[model samples]
Target: MSIKFWRSLPFQTGFSIALGAVLLTLILSIAVYNQTIEKVVTDSNHRISQLISTIERSASIAAYLNNDELALDVTRGLVKNDIVTGVSLRSESGMRIISGSPFNFKEESILHFPLASPFMPDEKTGELFIKPNQQNIDAQAKQMGALLVFTLATHSLMITIFVIFLVQNRLTRHLTDLANTLHKIEPGSAERLQCPTLHRHDEIGLLVRDTNQLLTAVQNTLAGERRLREYTETLEKETRKEAERDPLTNLLNRRAGERAISRALDKADTNNTRCAIMLIDLDRFKPINDTYGHDAGDHTLVTISNRLTDALRKNDIVIRWGGDEFLILVQQGHDDLQISVIADKILATLSVNIDINTSIQESIGASIGISLYPDHGTDPSYLFDLADKAMYHIKRSGRNGYFIHTPSDTA
Candidate 1:
């Protein structure tokens, strides 16, 4: 099907094992065939040599007596067997007697035997040549080849099937199960694996055990980190709230107010918008403290803080700027009229009669000083100084009401 199937471990391993078995079987079969053929050829050659040896004395006797009839009889006897295609007996002076079909020197093997005299054994008379038939050898080789092909095919098929069965059951199936288990196991979960053969002292079993140990470690690590992160988040929230809020009024402190103003200035610079800073100081607040004690002063301050918070827009920020004074930062999209309206609301809400639990209704006014970004002063410190100066100017003119700071007002 796909190339991935061929590349998988099972296919590759099975193919390799089958191929190796087939190759080994083939090589052995070829070697056996060659050895058998060689033995047959050697034995046949030996028998042919023996036959020549048996007739040698007679040939020697015939050659010594110069008997042509005996030489022809010897030649004809040698050619009677089907393996012997031809026979030739040649005398000392090259007088030759041949029997059967003429010999084909190129295609046939020639065996030579010397004829010796009986009386003087050392005396050589003639040569005998025998050419064995090639058809008999070819017939034997064909039979052997057929048997070899059948034997090799049968053994190769059996060996391949056996190897595939053994390998698939013993190795590939286990590995496939392990892989599937690992894929389904979620990281940081309480999941575990128990292989059937895990108790065995094999590499696969060891791998399974080690993997379970690693998963346990990961799960523990994840749990610990989760707890630590939750604790850290809680502490961070409490720390941030403490740093940003005033203890008495529950309003943002001076540090938080400054941070807020800096953020607003950055955003205003980017958006080409404007912001306003208003400073409010209560009139005649020291007298109430002097008359009603410090506890009463704290109560009045808390009450006034609540009133100021209720009067402002949701986006506006109010901070306790110090004793009897508060600072407000308003970002209303460059609308000075909206800022003035908010300031008026704060003044009206503060002017209401306040009961200090002293059987006397007390009322006080606030002196408000407003500053605009990029119009009054750009920096926080400079803008605060300008607003403070304007507030004092309102007090100098007479207590109560509000003043928008300008360069001419400062001059």
Candidate 2:
């Protein structure tokens, strides 16, 4: 799972808090309980040592005064020490003087007298032996047991409440705020998460700081995407505009003619009709531009352009074919004679005097080439080629005239 997802989970957050608290509490409790158990064991051993000292003193006094009954009372009292589970009194001659509990005599009791001490005293002096009080230890065990239960209950209750409050007030609120912030983000709107400022120097604060940093990165990403989208739209629009224009003439170019011709072809071909592709070339246009100024040539071309449009149908397309040439696409019925008639009409239209500049009103004429679909050629390119060849043939034969394309001319 992602860090964000794990951080957002309520159970995981609570579990983390509880785990930390439990670990700390266990370490502390173990240390304290070990010390308490050691103190109890030490105190119990001290009480046993004092009882053995009193019994030895009483035994010495009884032997010195020759008081048998008082010595018996001292021995009985020595047996009464609650922690002393077993006891024995042995004389210097290795004879057993007294025994307590079930055993009459045992080697372990004798071993305890020496084992309980680090170093035995003078060889002649008697010593005292002590054992642990199982019953009293049992009572202390019950008490420690109760204390342990109380400590665990108190610590667990406090820890549970603390973890619950920490998760609810800190983690849950932060995650919920983050979720709401994410929900508010819009595709184009300039908005972002505004996490509330916190004063506590804790993990949650660190988490909030990191979250804000991440949101900042997200905001930058969104902004960049919006800019890219806008740039793409503008580029697309400019590309579309460029596609419709003629680079040289600054008019609707060959691309426009193709679109118009395709539509016209679709309509004319449906009814088994025909369309005429008229290729018009300006006569002596290169010489005019070379002798005069290019500006004057361009103005002449523009003048000729206007004349051509005035002579043709409104539906007819007039396209600038690069330098000093234009293409006129016209829809016509199945009549080859009509194509010739339109060519004549165009010739007559251009025969008039055209004002090139303020002082010069020159005569500009065109060599017309005609190509008909399903008669001249079947395809658009072939028909365009046929008309182009015819225009070249007319130019080769003589300037300022017209010609119709034939299949043999193409070969």
* Top-TM-score candidate index: 1
Write down the lDDT that model 2 would get. Answer: 0.69
In the range 1-411, model 1's lDDT, one tens digit per residue, is 223878877888898998888788788878877876776677667888888888988788777777889989888998997777888888886667889888854553677778877789888887888887767866776677668767887878897898799878888878777877888889999888777553367877887889999999999999999999999999999999998999999999998988988888788778777778889999978999999999889989999999999888777789999899999988865455476677788889999988899688789789998888878768988889888888888888897888888777533
Task: Please list the Cα RMSD from the true structure of every candidate, rounded to 1 decimal place.
Answer: 6.2, 7.1
At residue 134, give the lDDT of candidate 1.
Answer: 65
Model 2: per-residue Cα lDDT over 1-411, one tens digit each: 134656566767677777776776676667666666666676777777766665665555443444546445665676776766665444343423343564433443232332121133233323334446657766775578559746875878697877778767766777676666757666445565555566236665666567667767777888899899999999998887788877545556887777777778778788677788989998867876886788878877777777778888777778886677788888764454388778888988777776666877777788988888768766888888888889988888886888888877643
TM-score (C-alpha, index-matched) for candidate 2: 0.62
TM-score of each: 0.68, 0.62
Candidate 2 off by > 4 Å: 1-24, 46-69, 77-81, 89-99, 102-130, 142-146, 149-157, 160-189, 197-248, 252-275, 283-296, 307-317, 330-353, 357-365, 379-381, 389-411
Worst 10 residues of 2 by lDDT: 109-118
In model 2, pairs of residues that clash are 83-133
Q: Which candidate ranks first by lDDT, i.e. highest?
A: 1
CA deviation > 4 Å runs, candidate 1: 1-8, 42-78, 85-135, 142-146, 165-170, 173-186, 189-213, 216-220, 265-275, 284-300, 333-341, 351-365, 373-379
